[model samples]
Target: MNDYKATVAVIGLGGIGGVAAASLCHGGCHEVVACGRRPLDRLRLERPEGEVEVPIRTLTDPQDASPVDWVLLVTKAQDTASAAPWLERLCGPATRVAVMQNGIDHAARVKPFIGEAIVVPTIVYYNGERIAPDHVRIRHIGDNDMLAPDTEDGRAFAALFENVPISVGLSADFTTLAWRKLMINVVVNPITALTRLRQGVLQHTDIRNLTRQILDEAVAVARADGADLKDDEAERMAQFIGGFPEDAGSSMYFDTLAGRPLESRALTGALVEIGSRHGIPTPVNTSLLALTNAVSDANG
Candidate 1:
């Protein structure tokens, strides 16, 4: 069984990271520390029913941090390299690092930074939007806020959020689930970012057609990579996109609007890279990645 009063350290304070810190603080069960470049006194989370406010114990320097039971690496996929300093100081043999970022192969991504610490890869379903440095809004996207592989560490990760609003589900077929989420991500994020529009943009006829090609190519790559995706996964993805709130925007969308570098390399780029290895043609994603990378480079 996992300890209820575990010491949890949260690295990165973006939208996703901010919600995580606030939720853990709201639980009041764990000793939670927020690690980032800047110090935050408190966090206010806008929930569906009400607002949750929690004081944050933030560490602005890696030298001030100690080993913790859990570390939620909530930085963007491109920012993982920058979090290495904190990982070095906060990780011990017994530490479990939960990676809550885009893309797959989470273990492999963090292996170089963490020596022997266990990696808990997760599929985040909650839509967390940072309104300000210390304020965020959480929109429950689906039944579960996150999904992890059904294992000891996964269960312990779930237990950590037991009293929080975020719900973590476990599944034996995590690979398939990750691919399923990837399909939706590749479509919504890129299309929205490129157009500077919201989820409502998915309703356009042109966007629908473009997303179809993107999903078709991504699913092919997923199948080649050993994911047990269904024949109609693209159609299912379209259905899900049709249900998204029109006013809602994706992380990439907001990033583009804010002139921040896009995470295209992680979302669209990952699929294209795998497609090359499998000898599968991902023309659609390649084109999208190229365009998005151009935008990301302009911002960088």
Candidate 2:
């Protein structure tokens, strides 16, 4: 018999967290313990495939946690500090912690709390929303893949989702892959939040042109930072954003609507900072970052 069974702890029971926890349970090869702001009895994952409810062992206190084989940090990029206490309790020497968040600096964000080598940077492309405290609705439009760096830990992390509906794979050029994804985030998230519209807002020609400008700057920065991106990557990302449902909203937009702190620093602000380091002017992203920060500060 195959003898490998992973013990997993999923911190951050938001939309992405719920999906990750449900997928782990659906795989049936792991024992999952969930940690969130509050405890949940079970998780309801409504996927395009079907709906599956999985009972979860939930904990709200870090002291109640134990070390596990894997730790899936699924919080927004800005909430990494709030999630660190749980990481301290749940991460053992041999434990691999996968940061499933936005932007390109996943390892940089969590490496101080966990060791550098043990932090597996990951990117998840599926759209999901938490409709209830214990329920999440996953929207499957085109791709629902999780990309990780090509490493031993990355392979082991991908292996955890073998039979699950989610696709997990390694990126040979992870830096480029991560930057490419960040370029999309730079264009789509802040604009949607600022406009108070869904993904379909990009369908407007003016907004689409603005998005292309933002993405072009990000692509230039990524290339300077050693990411192998195409010259027309901006247009391609704009086309991809057009593919989302009309009512589909990003996590940043949802957070803004819910009056929570927006993740502008992690998304647009990071772009500006990196662009400056490379001596590239990112005017569009810089303006978006300032506007997003102003709105978030006023609301939050």
Candidate 3:
């Protein structure tokens, strides 16, 4: 059996990171060392039902964070470089780092700092937001479903959340899972940001069709990258998009609307790059990427 008393160090106490920290802490699995650039005591969390005050040791610098058995990197994909200093300090010989972020390049993004450390890529399905430095609102906790490569460490990681409210498991085909999530994000995120509408707004025939176009391009890219996805994955993605709350807004939408730096490159930009590699025409994704970049630049 895996030990439940391991220490977990969480870097980047933003929405996803904070919620995961809180959940892990509340589950009593590990002693959480919440590290960020700011004070942890001042960090607050907002839940859909109400606000919960998270009790965690806040470290302003990575050097101050205690080395632990595991480290969960929750920063945006674009912030990988900025988080390098923290990874350098928190990762130890046996530390297994779980990356809970978007994109399919989780391992490639953090390999520079953690080097041979066991890196597990996780697909986070929660909807959360940081309304303030200390306050985060979780719109949907959803299922704690995470897709990681099947290995000894992967099984151990899955065991940590077993019997808890979260569902963690190994994916024999992680590439397909990651690519599937990427395609879903490509279709839903940029469109919501551009239209300034929630997910449900895409129910309109025109919006739904446009979403399909985006998914079609992304699916081509995924197939080119050797992911085993069905040809009908794009249609399923559109159907999934329609199931979210009518007023549900994506993280990218919220970030762009709040004037925060959007993770455009990680989302749409990566799609275009991958599509180019496969010689697949990704005009729809390319257009969305261009539009998102334009909006980001204009806002800046």
Q: Which prediction has the highest lDDT against the true structure?
A: 1
lDDT of each: 0.91, 0.85, 0.78
Tens digit of per-residue lDDT, candidate 3, span 160-245? 67544556768788889888888778877888888888887789899988988888888888999989978798888878877767
- Candidate 2 vs candidate 3, TM-score winner: 2
Candidate 2 vs candidate 3: the lDDT winner is: 2
- Local accuracy of candidate 1 as per-residue lDDT tens digits, 1-300: 345699999999878999999999998999999999998999999998799788999999999999999999999998898999999999999999999998976888898998889999999999888898999999897899999999999999999998887999999989889988888889989999999999999999888889889988988999999899889988888878788889988888988998999889988998999899999999989999999999999998
Q: Once superposed on the true structure, which residue ranges of model 1 sit more than 4 Å away at CA?
A: 1-3
Candidates ranked by lDDT: 1, 2, 3
lDDT per residue as tens, model 2, 1-300: 335799999989888889889878877888988998887788888988888898888898999998889999998887898888998898888989999899887777888776533888888877768889989987654454788888888988888888777888787899998888888788778989999999889888898789778888988899998998787877787788777678778777887898888889988888899889989999888999999998888876
Q: Residue 209 error for model 1, in Å?
A: 1.6
Most accurate candidate by TM-score: 1
